[model samples]
Target: MADELLRASGLESGYGGVQVLWGADIAVAAGETVVLLGANGAGKTTLLRVLMGLMPAWRGTITLDGAAVTHETTDQRVRRGVAYMSELGVFPDMTIADNLRIGSRFAPRAARAAAIDALYARFPDLAGKRRSLAGSLSGGQRKMLGIAKALAGRPRLLVMDEPSAGLSPLYVAEVLAVLGRFRAEGLALLIAEQNVAFLDLADRVCTLERGRTVFTGTTAELHANDALERAYFGLT
Candidate 1:
């Protein structure tokens, strides 16, 4: 991964009393879409929080753009060009426009309005809902608004958690398509997703179990040995 934009080696984190990630090692190159797949409670969210600097790392290292970010503050990370859009709406009560504007907190005051306007121009649906409260948007729209808020800051890396979770079929497609669009924009992404079908959109897929990585491969390999996925996922 010579072009890798972000990397984590021996990454471990969790509640103060215990550890969840057991020396997990993963990387995502510039503009590449890398997906992390795992069963619920497998430390997926914890790992994301650690990468975003929301949770302190108990041990190990994290690098963004080849520079060590192990000690950077969460806002420092954001200013360094990594945007996180958690599955939970981080801006629930704010209007779509406000949410995007709020994301500009890390940006220079002079550029904030231009940034928001650019994102609004890109996501017309959100632009349409700019005046409406975010709580009033449909589930899918809320999800889109969250992503748009992150993108408004013009981040180099977009880390999304279950962007398609709990969405209707149409919204799911829209969300996944947004990820695809990220690739075209040359924005690297590290996504945590539950739907196996979306694996087709990823450049690489890592499957985790009990906080350990068990599989890292291409979609064709996964599709050919579907049983392996079932076995790894405990579908039986």
Candidate 2:
């Protein structure tokens, strides 16, 4: 495989004294879409926070293309091209245009306009909302804005938390379509969610129980047996 865009080994983290994640290991290579599957309180969100450097790692290591970033701060990681997109719409109070501009702070001023245009062309639904306040957009459109902002930052690894959460079924399809386009363009995604319906769209699926990765492989491996899927997801 190509170089791993993001990798975490023996990663352990949590809040206060209670651990939310323990020795979770996963890797996303260039051009791969990896789905993280778990039920509520499964530590999927906590793992994403730790890997993004938003939460401190009590143990283990995170490497980006062979460079150790385990000790890097959130800002440092962002500078190194590890931008994360929260499920909550980013920049909901600002115009869609301004929301896009804020994420281009690291790029040369000359490229800002071109980046916006490019993103607009890539996502026309968001293009229509360019002049509107992000808060006024639909849930799907707001999710699009969050993703577009992350793309504006030129990130190598897109760590997303529940990109399809709290959306109408139609909106879910829209958001998943955007993710498909990104996947085709060779972006690495580390998505955490309880939505099993969309997990099959990913290149691989990994399940987390408590804080440990109990399974990691293709979506076929995960869904080949209905009983296994139920058991893996705590349906049993």
Candidate 3:
């Protein structure tokens, strides 16, 4: 499709010969949110790692904006307008601004300052705490900082693994609201999450079962087909 920003087909990858992904096919369009849902050990994080180029794909092709990126390094993919974020691994000792600075360093020098400034404007609270140690921030603020770091590179496609994995209800709402703005600003997002809190942010939902994509449809369709989801999660 003309709007498609990221496409992965026949993706198969695993750790040390233990095959995890089974010919997974997924796509994300510009300004669209595709929520990936699954139970524990369903290969959600593995799929994100493969998409971000953090892990090698045994077989498959990943295309971004019509260019093949299957063999591209994670840094290469980031420079090519793909950004990734996880629930962990923020630099706790660094200031919020500094963490973002590291993210923007790979971007063009001309755009770095402007990108940081724009992030501050989008996150006013962050603006107030820019110079403070990131470790001192609240759980929600730290997550926001992680998100800000990803945005510092100004990626067209954002691939996130469990953005709200261990947050309180209030924090989850805040994070989801932040993601909603990313969608409104025309950035494509592929999120792997187990929470239905993401339903409001998703344009489509895809469920994975035993490393395979078993359902892909609109949110309404997913809601109408509880039995399908139940079966995939082995609730039967």
Candidate 4:
């Protein structure tokens, strides 16, 4: 538990009186990459939103780095070292450099420029496209920009929603490879994904079904579970 960076228990939420998450529980340890896998419409994104504090949890407790943050605002969470990369992410109309600068806006004014520079160093392509509009980039390039933006804040925990969604296979590998580097750098990651490509990067896997966690274990355990494929696909 001391190694845990983020933990959510008894998570429940819904829209317009229709419940989607039912007492779901999950956690991500420091420097660990935990993959949330499930079929479409399985509440994967909803769960990520709840954990990121973008959406209120109806009944749950969320702790970030040993601090209770169930009620914390999204910005507050970011300030507390939690950064989220949404499915499509933000700042589509801006230039790559501008988007990264905005990510460091909450940091000390004197350090913001340096932070953006660091991100550019890490993502050289972004540096080359600094003046290019984010909307002009390819799908993979956009995903990279979003990730670079998240890292500009130097977060301890990175919550990404389907980073591989709608990406070409080559782009998916590139994106996942970038995430792999983050894990190596001791940044905890909680990624909601339907893509098995994420499996290779995960330290553990949690499969959700109808807002409930049906499986939580190492990659080996997940592979050994015969019911996983069926359960994930809603096959009888």
Task: State the lDDT at 45 in candidate 2.
Answer: 85
Output the TM-score of candidate 2: 0.92
Q: Report, for all candidates in order, the number of backbone clashes.
A: 0, 0, 0, 0
Question: What digit string (tens of lDDT, one per residue) describes model 3 on residues 2-71?
Answer: 6888999989999997999998889988888999998889999999999999999999999988899999
Q: Per-model C-alpha lDDT, please?
A: 0.83, 0.84, 0.88, 0.88
Better of 1 and 4 by TM-score: 4
Residue 119 CA displacement from its true place in model 2, Å:
0.8
- Clashing residue pairs, backbone N/CA/C < 3 A, model 2: none
> Residue-wise lDDT of candidate 2 within 74-192, one digit each (tens)?
88888877778887848778898998888777766898788888999998988887889999987777888999998887777788888888888888888788888878887788888
TM-score of each: 0.93, 0.92, 0.94, 0.95
Off by over 4 Å in 3: 229-236
The candidate maximizing TM-score is 4
Question: Where does model 1 exceed 4 Å of error?
Answer: 224-227, 232-236
lDDT of 2: 0.84
Tell me the deviation in Å of residue 175 in model 2. 1.1
Q: What is the lDDT of residue 89 in candidate 3?
A: 38
